[model samples]
Target chain A: MEMSALWKLSYGMYAIGTLDGERPTGCIVNTVIQITSDNPVIAISMNKNNYTYDCIKRTGRFSVSILSEKTTQNVIAKLGFSSGRDTDKFDGDIFAWEYMDGLPVVNENSCAHITAEVITMTEMETHYVILARVQDAKVTSDYNPMTYKYYHEVIKGKAPKNAPTYQAPEKITDKETWACQICGYIYEGDLTKEPEDFVCPICKQPKSMFKKQ
Target chain B: MEMSALWKLSYGMYAIGTLDGERPTGCIVNTVIQITSDNPVIAISMNKNNYTYDCIKRTGRFSVSILSEKTTQNVIAKLGFSSGRDTDKFDGDIFAWEYMDGLPVVNENSCAHITAEVITMTEMETHYVILARVQDAKVTSDYNPMTYKYYHEVIKGKAPKNAPTYQAPEKITDKETWACQICGYIYEGDLTKEPEDFVCPICKQPKSMFKKQ
Candidate 1:
């Protein structure tokens, strides 16, 4: 079948937040939907192997921070590409966040925030669909929230194995194209000789971010 | 905090197929997600009040036909605005579909067809998150999949009260603009007097299909 057709499905990027014991932790997810209106229930699909899933299982609570276009690449690199098991994913200047109901929430230029209590979980082979009831919700910004399409076509972020929208890496086609060292954005033309001020279109990193293969 | 940020989230329009007793029926939904890769699992959020939800509970099976940009607005009006319990939603030429694994599958110029078996269900405050394992899958066409954005901006389709994405109808700002009588698309200038051959930018319906309000 045409797998590319499935890729055309639109989605939004989000940072899922939860607590691991006394420490706050979370991961990135693209699947979060409002399941109900009256009491405001939501559903989120998460990989069973994710550290945030384990945390949610223990705490029975989590938060969804709707990321905006202004969110920096370092935030995704720390909370998404890196595993919380190996590093303190929320530590340092990479992200600025605060605690809500004892759970850490990343404030990395997000447009909205929602905290929910897990109501049920259904296991589906490689992933878990978690249904939760909204406990606290707050609007944070007027910025436009980032779409999953924009994350790929504009931000130039790669979907890791855990992402529901993950696609197998594409083979390189041309020799003149240069790839961003940080976000893997392919530049179709020679960027090396451009002014030193040139920045990566997807991640907005400076010219130093580009590396030739 | 800006609640308007929710406007940035992207979604798709679909006709969720199910069986009602010996008859086939379905409804509109905006929330569907691929939960896994290997065995291919999907999750859909449906309001408890929808007739299709009851049908799915009894049948334990359903089909998802991912609508394309080419689908007619009448398909949504026939299925979305009317209740199958009282109306023969599929009667006349309202919609063209066939039974698949005993459930109706819409053939309205969709991008793909997915038939799944219900594995688990979680009850939320006002809706249900139905997780199903895909049993059959097929690609139907190469047309661009219709996004919720395209539905609103192009076809002028509005989310029903039972839809997870339902928002208060936006106020119309201009009167000179000609709106598609069926899907609500507003053209920059009046096209009603144009030859009956004029077509809508969204659902692709001919001017003959529109009725000026």
Candidate 2:
């Protein structure tokens, strides 16, 4: 199969927030689709290994924070590249969030938030397709929701390894590309030209964390 | 719940092509998502009432035509608004298509095509989540794939009743708007000023079929 063709299938950037015991924990996902109109059941693909997946499976409740274009990459760095098991994704001042239905949701810059209760968890080889029914939802802003295309092309973000749409970084032979070791974000030009304080846009890692490719 | 918040969940415009016995038939869908990256598996939600759903269930194989921005609204009208049970959607000269892995797929103006074999069909309250493994796929063009936002905001096209994301046409009170009776496409202006041959850009219906709001 020509796997690259699958990249044409579009998606949106989202954070799946649920509680691990009393701790607010979550991770980034790109595959969220409404499965029905009335009562609005949405389906999201989560890798089985995701800590957030275990939380949602146990709690039976979760919140979908629909990330917008204006949403800073810091949100992705906190909730995506790192594991919720070790890091308190919502504890610091990286982004503002609020509890909806007892689940933490990104409040600032996100376009909307939907609280849902899990209805079914269908197992696949490497992922679980969690189907949930909408419990409550609200529009947070008028910002355009960030699409996977915009995230990759405009923000120069890289998908987490657990993402269903994640593809390996292509080999670069034509440019002086530097890849962020923390998040795999590629800096296309000479990395030294930037300020000493310049960090990886996607992961917020220091310049020292980037290695020449 | 503020149901309008669900609009922030993003999606792509696609044509799900499958066979009705020996004839070719399909419909438009916005909820196609990959569930795995290695030996990619995709999941698509199909409303139980759709004719194409039964066809895919019976045949156990289908093709996805990743529609691009250049793909005309005619493709949506032919494959979306009409039913394959009564109408031969692919018989006319409306669009170009070809068979891949014994299933028909849109050829021109589409970015890619993927043929898949059904892995499982999990029943839901109003729809069935059909999971399939990719059998073959090919990138057809370099054109940007169309997102659901672009389809509604730019093309002014309405979703079919069977779609998971289908929303009722909101009442427009502020302006002189005319809605196509066939496809529910809203044209925001006096319909009388257009040329005699000005068909509804969505379903190609005559101007007489439009009703002022």
Best by DockQ: 2
Q: List the residue pairs that clash in candidate 2.
A: none
State each model's CA lDDT, in order: 0.73, 0.85
Candidate 2, true inter-chain contacts retained: 0.83
Model 1 chain A worst lDDT run, 10 consecutive residues: A165-174
Residue-level lDDT of model 1, residues A1-213, one tens digit each, is 434445545578899988888888889898888777666777889998998899899999998888887775556766887677766777766569998667777786888888889988877777888888788778787665777765775456454544543332232334576767775555656777899888764456898877774
Each candidate's chain A: what TM-score? 0.75, 0.77
- Candidate 2 Cα misplacement greater than 4 A, ranges: A157-207, A210-213, B157-181, B184-207, B210-213
Each model's TM-score, in the order given? 0.73, 0.80
Give the number of the best model, judged by lDDT.
2
- For model 2, residues A1-213, the per-residue Cα lDDT tens digits are 778899999999999899999999999999999998998999999999999998998899999999987776557767888887777888757679989989999986899999999998988889999989999999999988989887886555444544443333333437788878887666778999999999876567899999996
Relative to the true structure, candidate 2 reaches a TM of: 0.80
Q: After superposition, how far is residue A81 of candidate 1 from its true place, in Å?
A: 0.5
Candidate 1 docks with a DockQ of 0.29
The candidate scoring highest on TM-score is 2
The interface root mean square deviation of candidate 1 comes to: 5.9
